[model samples]
Target chain A: MTDLLRTPLYGLHLELGGKMVPFTGYDMPVQFAGIMAEHQHTREKAGLFDVSHMGQVILRAESYQAVAGAFERLVPMNVLGLGEGRQRYGLFTNEQGGVLDDLMFANRGDHLFVVVNAACKEADIARMRAALEPDISVTYIEDRALLALQGPAAVDVLAAINPAAGEMKFMDVATLDLNGAQCWVSRSGYTGEDGYEISVPADQAVDLARALLAHDDVMPIGLGARDSLRLEAGLCLYGHDMDEDTLPAEAGLVWAIQKARRAGGEREGGFPGAQAVLEQIASGAARKRVGLRPEGRAPMREGVELFATSEGGEAIGKITSGGFGPTVGGPVAMGYVPVDLAKADTTVFGELRGKRMPLSVTSLPFVAANFKR
Target chain B: MKYTEEHEWLLPEGDLIVVGITAHAAEQLGDVVFVELPEVGTEVTKDEDVVVIESVKAASDILAPLDGEIVEVNEALTENPGLVNEDATGGGWFFKMKVSDAAPMDDYMDEAAYNKFIG
Candidate 1:
């Protein structure tokens, strides 16, 4: 087998007894204590995650507005309206009505910084470089390592380390000196809880992780818990809930598209595949991504076909992502089903092995989000 | 103790052999959330899947080894499945089955060989 890439926190993850596994070509930690325990720890106290494998790119230009307009051409989100020090979720759609990847972009008052999924980073960077001008440089921050401190105690733990972290609000980003290294800290994360994503210099990543783990409430978590936490938060896993054939509206990411890009808006359908995406927004998506809560103890899994009922029922949809949600105390999954079946508490059936189990189409986010306002 | 390459452990307990996953398998599987096993009295063949273990992230199938009919199962796992995580090979045994006949167990490993295989 080919060797997997290791993150900057590789040594530390080993030291903290992280169960390393191959994830998206990276030899990443899947769990430390355990998936359920680490998941519970993040929900109740604080969890420190090494997300250095994610792609962090800095879009440098003469001004933030210049890059914002160029960026708005790639995704459906209203990048031009984003204020300074503000971050917004965006999607890169292809020429066809499909989502290429989901990303987080921040207006740093001077330039734009975007973080995309680790697996799609190189492709995303290549696409941006080909589409933008030479002066509008897109540089991937290869020297930086990202860490996420999430949960109820994340804020207090961060503020204790850097007093400036206390001043930031949700979706706020600021470049501050964390310890001795210059770092970009954002008051946002994938977990439903209030958290911060800190982009620190690669050389000092170990020190930052050590500092966060020192807090009594903070425990080192791994990818296993991260998946469960994000699922409960109703966030989409790029390749799972969305893909090259999945549209933004169909993936339940319509909120990411501002009114400016919708039909009858000021700047209608300016991004790639605008015609199809805008039309879907106006008429509504045929198949929408919705949360599914399986009834009973058996947790459903991905690729399990969905049926109308247990008794020779018609096929409706298939589960894209399914797992046991620690917080939800049962099986929670996300899939694209017909819009008629996407309503609240619409009972569906998940075909597992040979038997079919009733799976209800609950709303997104099995657990209520606790994002800091 | 006989170990399968799939990480299952079959302990020779006289005629009623007990089956469970190895500790290495449990650690790799992470936390076991739910386990669905075949009902007692169901006939099974050697190396056939008879139990399904669900972790928080993925599901794993536990295969039967030299099996005939399932006699008993670890019912405690239905409510407290974490037992597999706590003690995978001991009290966390999945089920007990009456062996039709011990097949040519040449492919399976002993405890010492299994340890080296995992490493």
Candidate 2:
């Protein structure tokens, strides 16, 4: 317990009888009421989450264009095309084109703001510092805390507090007065729902959270339901679904690579591991990420070996993230397998414990996405 | 009836003892989504892990209360694992084992003692 860090909302969580567990470096709640009930509530109404543990970095330079260009050179996204108050999902890759972390990049008028996973914060910051030019200065915003208000009723609840919230589209961001405290609010979340991720000063965090919870449709959610929600939506977690050993192409994140960044293109910018990424784009990756649906009620958890039937029942893949998807009403998983066997409806086998469980390669986003965009 | 320090409850039935997680333990575990039980006829030692109970957040091992040979497992857990959350001390029995050494029963706490222990 001495080693675990606490967020600004720790006191509030304890007051609400949240079951705290060590996650990353913070003592976070795994659940509040319960996982299934909280999950269903979020799907039907709204769920409030304390995400202050995530890293917030501000990139400032002489001009916003310079910082944006410097950031674009480090990742594969089209950062320059982003308008003010717009946010886009980006990934930080290693020298081998493997993802280090997936993060959100926002063009905040004067400067570029970025938010990354808590577990990968140190490494991500070091990587950016090493890659960016000397002119670009990246500052860690340790004085801020982040909160997510998510689900279908999120707009209604937030609109009640700030009527302007109803006008914001998905992936767009704006500075709004949340309980009279100016904060950065982005219409984005990891739960595949219509939600707002608000960044406020640490001191104002508890007040904002309390104000949001006062809404009739909003309830406190914890990490337990967060994982299930993301799993059900087929979203890949940073450490589980990908790592330095996994290339972006093989991880089924080709969408993150803008078309303008393709090989032999005029707008193509030089970045580390550009040659390997281009080659992967042209020849196609050897293996690709896919969703797996196991037969029966048994779950195919991480580290489960996958066998390809066409190749003499060869072990060609491994489960990365797997669990019981409450919304899907069964067990679901995502893993990487040979490109040839990554097609939807393809038969596969997962070795669970000592028994072989029948599985099938299926399309991702097992549940429908409810983003307002 | 007796309870182990690990929060497992046992009731004598014929030559076997019915084993189930306590209500207090179930409430702490939140929702029980999956259960992995040992096969009948398998031998287990006291305090050794013999069953797995998974919630949406994590998976925990259920330790055997005493050394014995497993005689039966709860097949109901295969389809409706939430029984452990609904009635952990009653219908949610995990398995039954034929006692290998009756001496270990002395180490278990009686109902009143177990209640005081939890309190």
Candidate 3:
């Protein structure tokens, strides 16, 4: 606890009975009101998550286009095409077509504001600075904290405080004054539900969190449920599902890569690992990320080796993110398997505890995404 | 009734003994979504992982406290595992085992020792 960093809501989490644990470098709450209860509450009603540990950067250059161009060099996404106030998920790739980090960058009309994973943000910022010119301002905003309001009832609760927030659709962004604090509110979240991520001032975090928690529909959620909810949504976690060795396409994140950067497109290949990524796009990856369903009640956790049922039980892949999905009412998992075996309904076996359990390859998002289109 | 440092409880019943997790263990494990008990007739050694209790976030092993052959398992756990969280000491008892030897009971913790150990 002495060495771990504390979030603005650390004291508040302790007051709310959050079980504190060291995650990355922060003394974060792993659960509050239990994992299952908080997960169910977030799915059925609304839950607020304090995601302040993630890095927030304000990148500025000679011009807005110049800023986008500098960032596009590091990532495979079409940053230049991103519209004003519009947010798009981007991937920072390595020369071998591995993901350096997955992040959200919004075209804020003047400069590009980005949010990156907490564990890799420092290195992520350093990498960006190393590539871009010194004149470009790569400012890591440390005085701000992020909060996620998610679920079916999230829109109504947030809208009550700021009507403009409710009026926005999925993936929409607006910088509004909420309770006298200027915030960047985005109608997007990791949970497979209608939600918003608000970037608020650090000093005002507790007040804003308390105000939101005051709503009957909203409760405070912790990291345990956050993982479960995101897993149910088929979203890949940074360190677990992907790392520097995992290609974006192989991780089922090819959708984040735009066509303009692919082969026979306007921008052929310029980003790091663009050649490998483009080549993989033309010729599909050897293995692909997929969802897995256990035939029994036992959860097939991460590191469990997967095997094809045929050919004397040949090893195929391994579970990356696996756990019991509260919404799905059973154990659900995601792993990388051979391309041939990545199809839905393909039979595979998860070897755990010296026993083989039958697992079926299924399409991701075990629960339907309720994002407002 | 006696307790183990690993959080298992043993209740004497003639030659056979019932084993289950303590209330402290259940509370720490949180919501029990699934419980996998060793099959009846299976022989287990002390401190071996005989039962696997799964919460939403993680799976924990309930270690055996003594050498024994399993005689009966709590069938109700398969249908409703949450019973462990509701009543860890009573209906949530995992299995009944025929002790291979009772000498190991000397090393097991009593209620006072177990409570203090957990605290």
Whichever of 1 and 2 has more TM-score, that candidate is: 1
Give all candidate RMSDs, comma-separated. 2.1, 2.4, 1.5
Model 3 clash pairs are: none
- Each predicted model: what fraction of the native A–B Cα contacts (within 8 Å) does it retain? 0.95, 0.60, 0.80
> Candidate 3 — number of clashing residue pairs?
0
What is the Cα-based lDDT of residue A85 in candidate 3?
76
Error of 2 at A347 (Å): 2.6
Comparing 1 and 3 by TM-score, which wins?
3
**Model 2 per-residue lDDT tens digits across residues A1-373:** 4699889999999998899989998999988989988998898999999999999998989877999888977787878778998999888876787788899999999899999999999988888887774788888889888999999999999988899998999999999998988999999999988899999988999998999999889999999889889988889899999987777788888788887777766558466667777778788999988999997677788898998753345688899999888889788899998988899999888887666778988998999999998
Q: Evaluate model 2 with DockQ and give the value.
A: 0.61
- Indicate the residue-level lDDT of A131 in model 2: 73
Q: Rank the candidates by lDDT, best first.
A: 3, 1, 2
lDDT of 3 at A198: 95
| DockQ-based ranking | 3, 1, 2
Better by lDDT, candidate 2 or 1: 1
The two-chain DockQ for each candidate, comma-separated, is 0.79, 0.61, 0.81
| Model 3 alpha-carbon miss at residue A314, Å | 4.5
Q: Model 2, stretches more than 4 Å misplaced? A: A309-314, B14-16, B38-50, B63-72, B97-103, B115-119
Off by over 4 Å in 1: B1-6, B10-15, B100-119
Q: Quick one: best TM-score, which candidate?
A: 3
